[model samples]
Target: MTFQSTTSGIWIPLITPFKAGELDESSLRRLVKHYSSIGLRGFVLAATTGEGQTLDDAELERLASVCADETSHCSCEMPIYLGVSGSDPRKVEKRFQQTKHWPIDGYLISGPNYLRPSQDGVKRHYEFLAGSTERPIMIYNIPYRTGVNVLNETMLELAALPNIVGLKDCCGSPEQSYDLLRCAPKDFSVLTGEDPFFYNAMVHGAKGAILTGAHVLAHVHLEICEDLHNGHQKLALEKWNRVVHIPRLLFVEPSPAPVKHWLWRQGLIDSPEVRLPMLPIGDSLAGKIDAAVNLQGGTDWRI
Candidate 1:
């Protein structure tokens, strides 16, 4: 079959479920099914939320294998996209060169972070990366972390490339996003990378989102997307409001750290372990996260 995204609703930026400083394949299996049972569409393995920056090629491959195996067998027919990128174009190129042979459905590549390439450079970077791989590409633009913005003009230019199929727009600007939606060709999907804008993105014509917050509330989030597509606008808005603060909550203490805390409490993984420079949520933040979780009716709020 030709490569296509089955991503629309609740495509979890899945947390890397580890234990005893090793890959927990069992937890990976259980996690996929847990979301699948809740009607989540797919898995975004090894993305930023999965700590892609810290994972080696072998580890990514193993996680991809587990996700693919589990997703294919699950009732949801979920597709898995492997996220890969770095500040160095050459380093990211090397990664694309290395993993081009893997079985993932596609690659979700972010703009070069820190170095902050110019607009033309960003386009060229994606051009070269897409040229290097057979996998379809989804350009990720999250300026908050990346320090570079893939403006709508650049996005339109990149959309013309055959292999460049979609974008993860986290530039955090609704005006730019709406303009892209108005101008972008239908097949060139515009998926939001901003978790808070999930419902609005869908309502305003975004195809979908790549959300880290969905890891805990995948079912509800996916239902919101489905509700909009099915013309249930009121219902979609209501569902969207239910956890809009989730992005802020999960992001308050650096990504994946807060998310890890929630997952650990749910018995989905072991200790809420994060790599160096990213420690566990402190007591104050923990209390805040707990309150947010409780407010959202999430029973898994311990830290």
Candidate 2:
């Protein structure tokens, strides 16, 4: 199957909704409907924002299947991408091979987390993964998480690979992003995984954003990108202003926690449950998240 980038609008990295230490299929279904109704371009399951680290293989497969099932059930053909990454490049590539037959649209592979490979290593890592699978690959270069940055030249080199399609740029450096916009191939996508930079990224030629905030405000954030893309600069600016502070709040504690908190309040999930090594969000952070959710009017905020 040929997979093209759905290179515009809000692409929500879904949170794993759990119950009794098991995947909550019902809540998963509810979230699918909720986002689709609100006009999300697509859904990304089992990504960083989806709490992929805590899930088992059974759970991962179930998550992907449920998303595929729910999207079709709603008569919404939103594309679904699954996150595939790990510390070892070989292990990551093995996992990617495992998903070769899964019912997903694409793979969002982040750079190795702990090893912090050099630029040559980063390029070689992706080159290996890209060659291992025929699936379209979206490189996730989150230096904050990975401990190393995939620089522009390396990215352009990877972009030339036959299977490597684009990137989810969370380098947290606008300078790198600007350089990428100036240097990357026209077909190579440079979506901002950094929500705070979404508007600026769009203005500087980002294809779109794969944002954590999209879990809460999918429609508005997507519209912000779309408006900017379609030359509706004034309206895009207004929308951007409304959600500008969200990234800070969401990251105040750590990812998926604040996002899960918001989803819990909306009744989309059972608990704001995070696995060990990542405890439940603290009261202080929860309060701030609650305030933001309330401020945005409980997931029904007008874009």
| Model 1 TM | 0.90
Write candidate 2's Cα lDDT for 173-255 as tens digits.
88989999888887787788887888888888887778888887677776776677679999999887877888788888877
The digit string of per-residue lDDT tens for model 1 on 173-241 reads: 899998998999877878887877777788899877778888776777778777887899998888777
Each prediction's Cα lDDT score?
0.78, 0.80
The candidate 1 region of ten consecutive residues with least summed lDDT is 1-10
For model 2, give the 10-residue run with minimal summed lDDT. Answer: 1-10
Best by TM-score: 2
Q: What is the lDDT of residue 202 in candidate 1?
A: 85
Judge candidate 1 against the unseen true structure and give its global Cα lDDT, from 0 to 1. Answer: 0.78
Distance from true position, residue 279, model 1, in Å? 0.5
lDDT for 36 in candidate 1 is 68
Best by lDDT: 2
